[model samples]
Target chain A: MSADAGTDADAGADVGAYADTETGADTDADANTAPDATATAAAAATAPAGTPPDATPWRRLHPLSLLVTAQLLAGAAFGAGVPVGAGLAAHIPFRAAVAWVLAGSALLLAGGLALDVLRLRHTRYRVGAERVELRTGVLFTTRRSLPRDRIRSVDLTAHPLLRLLGLVKVRIGTGDQTAGGESPLQLSPVRRAEGESLRRELLRRAGPAAGGSTEGRLAALVPRWIRYAPLSFLTPLLAMTGWGAVMQVSQWFGAEETVVDLVRDTFSPLPAGWTVLALTLLFLSAGVVGSFGTWAEMWWNYRLEREPDGTLRVRRGLLTTRSISLEEARLRGVDVVEPLGVRLSGAARVDAVATGLSRRDSEENDLSTLLPAAPRAVADEVAARVLRAPVALTRPELAPHPRAALARRLRWSLGAALVPVAVLLLLAAALSVRGLAYAGAATAAVLLPAAALLARDAYRSLGHGLAGPYLVVRSGTLRRSTVALRRDGVVGWTVRQSLFQRRAGLVTLRATTAAGAQAYAAYDVGEAQGLRFAEEAVPELLAPFLVPDDGAVEQPAERTCPDRWSPVRT
Target chain B: MQVVGIDREGRNRGPGPAGLRLRPPHHRVDRRAVAWWRTRLLLAAAVPAGVLAVLGALLGPARFWLLVAGAGVAAAGLAAGLGLPAWYYRVHRWEVTDDAVYVRTGYFWVDSRIAPMSRIQTVDTERGPLQRAFGLAAVTVTTASAKGALRIEALDHEEAAELAEQLALATQKTPGDAT
Candidate 1:
């Protein structure tokens, strides 16, 4: 490709290098493991007849030894302690047990060393037209075959040692294991160049995965995703504000007399206002730090790439770098998450949920984060690339409506302060006006402003959009959440015309995806549209997986469920 | 031959296309039977948790159940979870092919995984007391993933090691497949 074409492709996005090549030198450290003389000889003999005699063999995946050795050693240490304690506490002679323990340790160590060499020598990986096959084992050799098309996600990770060796490990996560068994295929101690090449092959094998770069001009407004690390203070900031208000309310009402008594014990010369200011500063400082952790926990190094097969490749990491590739067809939906900062500054974070991934579970949420830095338009471009559809985000469907949002906040604040107000009123009836003063101050400042902000933020954060097979619902004030379910992918969608939503002309839409189900959120859209979207998403995503009912006899209503295993299978 | 984990049949299989296949005569296991057993084993892995939950609920009222259940589940879960790893050893089977490796493990959750020659990173073997008693060994093959590489287990140790050696060499023998 010419520079002009490359420039056009990159446009506003940063495209420093089509590929990072300097890391090749760094990957050499781990490549220097003890060479296998046997493998070398065989490699020479096995050379194809027409090939040059001195052709260097492709680098074998470094066998996992020192790492496995460390694991076995640690496990053996526990074994050592148990037997020593047995010998000391019980009458049994520790000598035999200790010898056994030592022997076991030796075996484990040997296994580690042997496996390392074996890993280097045995398995050969080949990505064929239809699938990937792994063959290796001694007498009863084993081979595993996976259709490239069926892979859900190709996850990449690197331990500190692996990282030091400039090697990263990759896991092919297929949502099949019930016990959450570790993935069965891995290539550790891999050079970055080769690893990326394998990744490209998987994407090409699956279909092109595209995301992020399509925003045409949106890269200028949003940070160049690569130029950025990531900024996340939202979750923790929300936590602090909410928790701080709770602490303030507790101190003012529940522990008032005790605090008053303690204050009365202080030096008589100290002024009340000075004491309040000092306490406020201390409390706010703690709250700030507390909230920071919440945001820091989720912040990660995120980079989004457009794969050749039109899938979105998201790579993110904190300690252990992880990579997940999502096909546009696999995406449920897409939405631009706009905070107050985004709405004001024309910068927004884009997020989406793909099939079989859940963001509700905090564990899944860490893995589910798709894009964190792209601008609203850039996100729209990514939606086109990754989702293969473009959506123009509409004005948010604010909860309680915009006008009612303030009233809802006011009503909630009043309802919350009622008990304290009643107690103050009762106390006033018995002749103490100070309690009433405290209640009034607390209600006016903390409760009212806090409630109002929350309601407003909640309203601002809500949105819904429809683009082809996708039904996108956007919500959450800080950790902006957007759930996209492909209309075709839905297994079963339920439309609930409850007394409240039906009467209000609103409806709840719930749909089940490959992994589990998602429910209707509080969005201002009509139930008719929600139901319509569900109808679309059903055949869109589920067409491939759902085994059609081919005229099987329907059992009686009273019959116990025929298949006990359907839950996991489904 | 299919009933036993031992690929004792001298006609071992290697990966290849179904008919234009240069595949080494491979050992094909009873996948359905393996799946049936693996499902039970995976459930057994979680037996301790279920027992702890049931016991805790039965012994304590709602208030203390959470605490009791938590402790009981932790203990039972750890104790009973050996079913997964154990059954994994029992049912894990592999069939080598001309171009790639095929691994099938677990009784119920059958993993019919194929790692091609290009993508394979490592392969290793192990022998423990149980394997020693059975005169069997374990082989693990590693491939790259997002987090770390995955190590697919359940191989006939010595053979798997030798096979791995064979693969490492054949990887060079083949062209274009090695990325």
Candidate 2:
């Protein structure tokens, strides 16, 4: 909510210049106020080189332990829900609704607990000119340290809750994936004034920002900490706002229920409109709660900042404020994770694959996106920019295709809808016009939107431009997506045509990286292009994916030649 | 007519390499393959007869029993003719080297395809209870295409595993340059 800088030199204001590197909140004259946040900072500013430690030079971050307990608890809740949701979905008739609500509530509680854990975890991060060491990881205990020299960028983040806690998480990304996204160190919740000063210090170490940031790689870097809004609220809110009114009206008229009962008795079927509405609310509530619960944990302590040097910094932690900086060149690959619920709103998460450890271990779930529905353009721009290249499609345009709107589409959908009805009529079920109309409702509700979507999706397929050094493939039909490739950046390309596809003269294309293959499968494209892709995309796309299975690779020894497996030709 | 030659390791103990050679795989008639073929042929022949048998069963006191008998014989024949070959393909074994792995099996076709190791990119080891019964395993060496999937049937378990490891190492070392 507020800030301070360079005014108090008595505490160590001489080092004020470093704090000003990012914020543009700096001036030369005031040397006094900058070091007010820490006695160490103030002392460092004033002390001569010969100044020995008045006390111990090392500060122990172990004092903040409670926050970790909360993280462990949240992880436990996540693990528990894995079983509960899957286990409970099959029973109780309203099992889905009950399961979602229970899971959502549990997650919400976990989110609250996680904030406290993060707070305890935040106190351990300490930064120095030589190295920033962040210590976190519950079971697989880890302490990550990045030499300031290796630091590619510095990211500072703060959110409302972090502000409330008077703490922030500082992360220094070293273009490494070995240790998961845990910064070499965290500042844990440090004084707000001190956090910025420290961020500047890191930037000064990282050096000046230059270059008209390359094409295809810049993406919107979100603040690490912010308010967490549970996505569960939307659907429930919609149903309540929309269908809830319908239920309310039906209940008020009471006569509506009588009519329904009379019709149900005559038809001998249960017509429980209220039950249906309630079930809908239940699903929405659970989904929203689980999503919002995590949101609360994430945004409850989120802060994101765009650094002057083209690095997007994020800082977040409910209990332990986490800060991390990602520079343009500090990544090998970028991935978007779309959890099932997030997929409903067409949202995805983003993570950078760095060099050190694989992302599962190095990229802390901390610096990833918290959005429920970021567009494909945003994904493309972010991936391309962060990877330090033009994303082939930074800003994508939407094109609605008419492939499905033609006569064939209508015929097929109509045929699909009519098949059952026609079958019943043939069976002499006496499906009258009224009975046929009952079936027709399904055709309208189920088939119409799907047909519209099919057409819209075909329209949405943006043409791809495979130009640039890498084969930057930009294609998105519905939830628009552009997969950019550097021709030299892939490890290999696999093309396959199923029997049906072969008959249609089509093939599936996949680009494999050490991480895995990018499935451009089932895409309709020219065979010639698919054939050329292996030659063009594999070399560069697959380089990063090649992980030495524990560095045992050695040059093969020469043998006289007899022991070889021959090819199988049928 | 018998043929003799050195075993795979090139030990020259038999008839000094100037011996008669057996006909190539395609020319040889696999007993199992022929027997299976006959069964299928017989089943096809029974189709019209099956209807007659069923009719006879209905009219003649033996009814469903006659139909059942015919079907049972056809089923048994189908199983005998087909089961072994299916098992042969499923329970094959191999020991692939840099140039070729030996293969031997017969259900319908007593045939072996020894692919030179130079062509293989991956070697897979497969086993099952039937394979275990022989204390053996099947080694399959695969390239990047379906035409490249070569299977060698029935190798000693340890030998199969070692050969698979060797083939893997060989391919990894010289895949692009392998002649």
Candidate 3:
């Protein structure tokens, strides 16, 4: 299990490179069965009852999958043995402990391999006319089936080991959010050709392509985009992860204290401030390097293309390559996201706001991403081409929110900044600590201006506008996102006003859609302006409830009207 | 009722002298909703409060503080249980128009949702034990949007059923998958 976990971590860490070898496998699979896959799909669709069951019979995973399982088990045994051997060495002779560890590992490996072989023998899947079914297990068999029409996605992925063996994992998703974290259907370590054929057959649309001009390459990897990798929030997080990993490994080896002592001694000669500064610089540089490698691994050979059948396909990854297919018919909009660091560097990433693009746990493997962080112009261009809009919907100038919005942000920001400072000062007063007082003052000095700056930036980020057939909303400071949602896609409107907002005559309007993020808001706009915007964005939706404000009538007071009535005794 | 005086001809008059304003929805929730809310709140608060009181009585060293905390919780629960239900009843309102379902809810922070009839996917009536005991039911109008489900809580059970039927019929009249 530990060895399996280790390999899983290795596969997850550089999700891109897992499929370098699988590229050849994929192309070969396409070449072999491209036409056959389509023909079979057409036949299945047109004559479900006429086609013989043998034509689409239950298929087992490639025999090489057993080899893959055995190899993983062997690696796991070695991985588990070393730590156990080391622990045993302390209690017994080194040679004797080593022998015991080796024997134990061999026994464990044999047991694991036997179990996998049973699993391999039992597992079988078939693409039937109406449903795709998988049956697997020995004592307790589980048969799961997904209706063909309900199938939303057929993604193909290959980690390094699977890629090396010319196999890919096929995941079929229905976009249904089942409770209890039940995962979508998966067929792991299938021969690349079989996986390709299954994917093509499952995702084939019955109708003609939406537009012939819209099909083809939308975007490809630009090598220089790697420069923006270190400008993401992931860099600092990666640096911390790296530091933690080093500490954890050292502790396992019983050299944690030694390494800590070495570091302390090296920094002991410097002042505390210099030591802190130097450590920060060191960690930041390490993070920058890590980010660059991560970017390359994830975005290398990245390509976005619309298939002739109107399926948007994103194929990328340096090591463990992934191919994700999304039906263009399901796409409601696109989101152009710019994190604080990336925004400063003038780069943004584009994500699809499509129904059924449900992510499967891992944040790194976001299925909605259409383009990784790239030049802002390129991001806009790709977004425009993907939506087939005349110009980038995110380019138009949006209506600025009321000034009261700025006031609200300022109040919130300053209050948040002062809370810790106030706490420190109160502590200083209670404890009579002069140093704490100084620290509180210093904190106030730094945080106040920074908070004010952020408040201003956040206020500036607020804007909403209509572009062609889409309603665009732009907001956020730390991670700015400009979403362009189809006007017709909005299913409902939620208008909210807090006591503070009511006092300021402002409202936050959220446009609810079935696509990405579910609800996007136009935050803290003037009440009248917001109502007008909502009414205009989706004509006639909010018109009936809206009444002209005849100047003679004042806005209703916040307090409930005194017209109490008894409960109806139905 | 406040907005009934306005004529349909006035709708396209655009911005008024001051500005356009959203009129409150037509009907308030059934008055029994207050009792339902109070019962629910008290029921929710009872378990923790009872546990704390029991612990206060049993534990020696921490008895006084635990008892004080229990009393505080009970007091807060009582205050909110008595005061908030009426406030919520006053605020919550719902109306089903020909083209859309308009609902106004929330007490301190008011929220109004308008889901077009064309976009509604399903209409369901839910009756919990307490609600059933009170002869009331809640009507839920679900739109294609995940967050666009509008629940008109604490209506007469028959009224809720009728509303659901009306909404279902209105939705059925429109074409295309709501998404």
TM per candidate: 0.45, 0.45, 0.86
What value does DockQ give for candidate 2? 0.03
| Stretches of candidate 3 exceeding 4 Å from the true structure | A1-55, A178-182, A206-209, A268-273, A359-365, A551-570, B1-18, B45-67
List per-prediction Cα lDDT, in the order shown: 0.46, 0.44, 0.79
Winning candidate number (lDDT): 3
Q: Which candidate would rank higher by DockQ, 2 or 3? A: 3
User: For model 1, how does the per-residue alpha-carbon lDDT over A10-69 read when each residue is reduced to its tens digit?
Assistant: 321211120111122113422323111112222323433342221212235655535645
Interface alpha-carbon RMSD, every candidate = 23.4, 21.5, 8.5
Ordering by lDDT: 3, 1, 2
Q: Could you tell me the lDDT of residue A365 within candidate 1? A: 55
Could you say which candidate leads in TM-score? 3
List where candidate 1 sits over 4 angstroms from the true fold.
A1-61, A64-145, A175-184, A208-302, A315-322, A338-347, A358-366, A373-381, A390-441, A456-472, A476-486, A489-492, A497-506, A511-570, B1-179
Q: Give the Cα error of residue B65 in candidate 3, in Å.
A: 4.4
Q: B17 in model 1: Cα distance from truth in Å?
A: 62
User: Per-residue lDDT for B7 in model 3?
Assistant: 30
Compared with the true structure, model 2 gives a TM-score of 0.45
Summarize candidate 1's per-residue lDDT along B59-178 as a digit string, tens digits. 656637654656655655455454544555444444444444544443443333444444454556666554454444455654322111223343334444666676666555644311
lDDT of 1 at A437: 66
Residue-wise lDDT of candidate 3 within A1-570, one digit each (tens)? 122465345323222221232232234543222211112222223432421232354567677887888888889887778777877888899999999988998898789888887787767777877667675667665555566766778899997889999999999877654222546788987989988888788878533746557558999998999999999878999999999988977776677899899999999999999999999999999999999998887888999998776788999999989998888878899999999989999999999988755545324446889999888999999999999998999878888887888999999999999999999999999999999999999999999999999999999999999998999999999999999999989999999999998777788999999888888999997777778889989998898888666534443333233321111111
Model 2: residue A343 alpha-carbon error in angstroms = 13
Give the per-residue Cα lDDT of candidate 3 at A500: 90
Q: Each candidate's chain B TM-score? A: 0.43, 0.46, 0.88
